[model samples]
Target: MTDLLDPVSPDRAESFLTDHFQGVLVRPGDRSYDEVRAVWNGMHDRKPELIARCTGAADVSVALRYAVAAGRAVTVRGGGHNVAGTAVSDGSVMIDLSLMNRVDVDAGALTARAQGGCLLRDVDSATLAHGLACPAGVVSHTGLGGLALGGGYGWLARKWGLTCDHIVAAEVVLADGSIVEATEDDHAELLWGLRGSGGNLGVVTRFTLRLRPVGPVHHRTGVFPLADAAAALALYREFAERQGPDLHAVATLKIAGQQDWIPERLRGTPALFLTATWFGESAEGPEHTAPLFATAAPDAVLTRLLSFAELQALGDHGEPHGNRYYTKSCYLTDLTEGPVGQLLDATREIASPLSAIDFEYLRGAIGDVPDEDSAFPRRDAPYICTVSAQWTDPAEDAGHRAWSRRGVERLAEWHFGGAYVNYLQDEQPGKVAEVYGSARYARLAALKRRYDPENVLSGNQNISPAAP
Candidate 1:
């Protein structure tokens, strides 16, 4: 039987939380409630009634079951980097695993078992000690659990596949409160859904990832002043097509004055920055990258070979929480003049300093993989572009959000008909259907019905169960 608590009663919610939860659960008046409710993006301002800080797999199981038994919405949090703030829900029970950050590396099997709450930095530090690395996201603080679940592709993606590709096994707590081990040999179908399923099926308690030997290498960042956005886009396309699998680059359109690397006058203008990493040795990287740099006059050329750990932290710091964030992304087929012109048109209207755009080239190990091998089906899409807009005042929310939409709207005609699910913001209920193709979406929907028929986990890019 389920326990019935008063909808407006904190004491009622706290009683069951403290009694059964092995970790801390904060409420409205609690001292740490405010801080615990905050997430990575400054945009998300949700106030859940109970914030349960889970400790282990058992703790996660208890939290989910308790939410069901108590009739409360549940939000599973890890690194809390979901740009849409799906990690926390308003007036719900937040199952936070931020404290369960443990990484175990097994050299004999060339695999690492990473806890759900472990950050990318923790995984890198642990795996790099053995000269091994796996494909992860760019941000160091991004959680391994969410990243792997969403099909992570980082600098190492060219040589190694996305984070999902390296997933050897997973320990998941199903919606019915059963612990299941998903791998290739056993429960294979569930493992297929986990890749890029975005947390719909279960809460992944642990991930066993395949690792490869990666040298302590240098990360190279180059810049070209954005005088003509069209030319920059053309050059990037040409270079990326010819660049072999060893090299990787992401083309960013920044709001000129953000970085000290650009000249004073060029500040606040649209500029192109090429950030790449050479997994082998830093000295040999420039030779391959010279072609791309030669396409335009150099604004800044700062290249140094640093340790893998140092390389990962470049241009990364803590993001302020409690700000309004609106982001949208899509996969692009090309970076031609028409698309570049559309991007520039949208750039001119961005009013917020926090507004910026990025065009991440998708190739190498990411695009080279078979489409059917994983749930991230967009293998032919060459580019992933994202518009991230942020603002402080609630009144300014409309304008910032408009800018984000306009940026993509301008390229609507050129859209590849698919998007990156992780980067999607709130939109039509069928948004996930648009991001993943209709066929793949249907397959995923059926799978969701099998694993989570009641839709207990619907916070992510949700996959609702099929009708009976």
Candidate 2:
């Protein structure tokens, strides 16, 4: 690997780049350089040699051409919200796409086209204006490019399916600085690879996503005493299995905090929380969720009608950017008693008050899609167990990370042997293959050879090109 840190005269590089580029070129000491380099995870404080703030697909091509010609490592930053912090790297040419956030909604066609740099909130706000939305992540601040490319899931997933399932077309800048549109009839293979492979083949400049009719939903959230966790989880599993496609829910285990909704005595105590949303009429939500409240006997419960956008923003307050984060996750084949016990035990050792163990219910429309339809292949799993650790103090990093790791290890026996690519924090060898399986990884590698033969876009969860 060539050292991207090798000295290149700033004036010469900037002049050459600006001559053909329509975007700003930033260097180490330039104003806004630090702001551009910062990512969602505060743990990565990398210093890139140059930052190319791209305005459009042409600007992306120029940046890629510059990186290839200079023989420098290239890192692409869309929203800079990936937990792994792969968007920016030390001693690399950072292609910053934060400036290219433009959303175009075709209400008549029920589709929306968003630029690479748009956040979940950007797409949601635009699509909701037409009373339609695409299935995406819960946090509004997360980048659309990363989440969708990694097979997005949210409240709408149970009804409409994942974000990848809604993708109709994409505009991509390939490794050779060529721009092309990937649709079912065009560069179709690339589109298949992009659905869940995490941006290894090219820089996606725009994504045209199919939208569905969505509006205010009945949202229910509640926190129960720790003693009720076992019963609550059991009831949740039963409810998830019996519920219709319109129901999307999550059950989380964590220590309660100073929220006004939590009882004063229950604050700072370990608790189990159940959150559910009904995509259909708000009036029917209570009937569907009444069983859960009856079984768990929560200490607090809040149920109301909220816009789809508001429901998406529910988790944002707890997960502010700039907090150090580490996560380990796996798909659950079954939520058996043994794994549930392990999770409860792990929660007892929480290192930070902000840390949590979350289990998302998966079924209905998500399972209706064939596994081979896209690169995302864990359709058989019933749930995804994520152990997330977050903190502000650098000194608490080791403890929190260890807690997360142990939690995953304890529950490994119940895992389906597949992991969510978006939740992956480190580049463990064989991890990609484990996530996608051998056959799908082989197909992805072949696609990589076709579109990114030299591996110019290797900064992400990379799938190397197949041997010639």
Candidate 3:
């Protein structure tokens, strides 16, 4: 029989959690509660009644089981870097896994086993020391757990694959408080679901990732006036298609910031930018990138050789924490003049100067993955567009959100009928099904029944078991 606590009275909740939880237990009034509950996105200013800091898998199991017995839900926080701010829930036991970040790299086998609390920087730093890498997200501060579960997209995505593709195994704690090792041969469906399931199935405590050989990479950037966007983007598409997997790139529509590479006059002005990274020998970078300059000479250009770790952190400054963030993402069937024109119009209407409109080129290794092997959708989609709305003012929330949502609404016609789970904002439950499609969602729902049937872990882009 379960020691289910009184739903009305929580007098004994503290004593019971403190006695059972092996790690630190933080109350609402605790000094670190505010800090611990805080997540990357400033939009979510929530407070969980209890913050159970877990040291390892054993501790996480205790927290999940405690939440059930205490008649409350639980939310897990890895690096707490998700834009959706799904880590903390109101009046729930916020399982703080940030303390469990530890990575072990096997250079000989080209593999990295990282704890779920680990950030992109943790695996990048550890693996880079051995001249190897686990392809991950662009922001180093982003959590490895959420990124992998949702589908990791980074500079090396074209060269290698999404971070989830590198995941060979994982140590996950289920809603029922049972720990299972998911891999190809054992619990195969669970592992398949984890590739892009968006944390709907379990609290993954550890991940064993397959690493790739990567070291110093060369990067080149060309900033163009808004007037020259169509030409530059056309050239960008051709270049990305022509170049081999060793080349990875994207086209961004953003306001010029205070970067040394950017001219002072161009600062705060909207510009179309083309950026690419060469994963091959740094010396051969210029030859491959010369064509990018041929289409339209940039207003200014900057090129540099960066170590894998350094390149991973380049975008960190742009995506600062404690800022209101709302984003809508969709994969485009094509990047024709229509989509490009709409993108430019959207960029001009950005309510916040920090906001950006991005076109990320997909395919290459991302498309090479067999569909049956993982649950990630639209791997074959050639382009993914995201409208990022960032602001600091609470007064203009309505305006900023309206602009951001409308920005995506403009491109509805070109949508490839799929969405990336990682970039999705706080949409309705039906949106989750729409992203995965009926066929794939059905498969995942059947698998959900095996693990989290009751949906104890239903905080994220949930995959409901009872869905039709």
TM-scores, one per candidate: 0.92, 0.96, 0.96
Candidate 1 wrong stretches, greater than 4 Å: 1-19, 258-260, 318-322
Please write out the lDDT profile of model 3 over residues 177-291, one tens digit for every residue: 7889999999999999999888889999999999999878889998988888888888887887778898887888988877888878788889988988888888999887778
Span of 10 residues, lowest total lDDT, candidate 1: 1-10
Q: What is the lDDT of residue 53 in candidate 2?
A: 91
Q: Per-residue lDDT of 35-152 in model 2, one digit per residue for the tens?
A: 8799989988899999999999988987887787677899999889888999999889999888988999999999999999999999988999899889899999999999989899
What RMSD value applies to candidate 3? Answer: 2.5
TM-score of 2: 0.96
Against the reference, the lDDT scores of all candidates come to 0.77, 0.86, 0.86
Across 1-468, the per-residue lDDT of candidate 1 in tens digits comes to: 324222324335445555656877688999999898898876778899788798887778777777776788888898898888899989998889889888999987899999888889989999998988777887788888888888887778777778888889999888866788999998787888788867788998888999987765645566666566567567778887776767776777766665576677777666667665566556787676667767664677667777767766664652455667789887777888888887777776778766778886777777777777778867677788888887788888888888888888888877887777777667787777776778778878887887888889888778878632
TM-score pick, better of 1 and 3: 3
- Determine which window of 10 residues in candidate 3 has minimal summed lDDT: 1-10
Full candidate order by lDDT, most accurate first: 3, 2, 1
lDDT of 2: 0.86
Candidate 2: residue 359 Cα off by (Å): 0.4
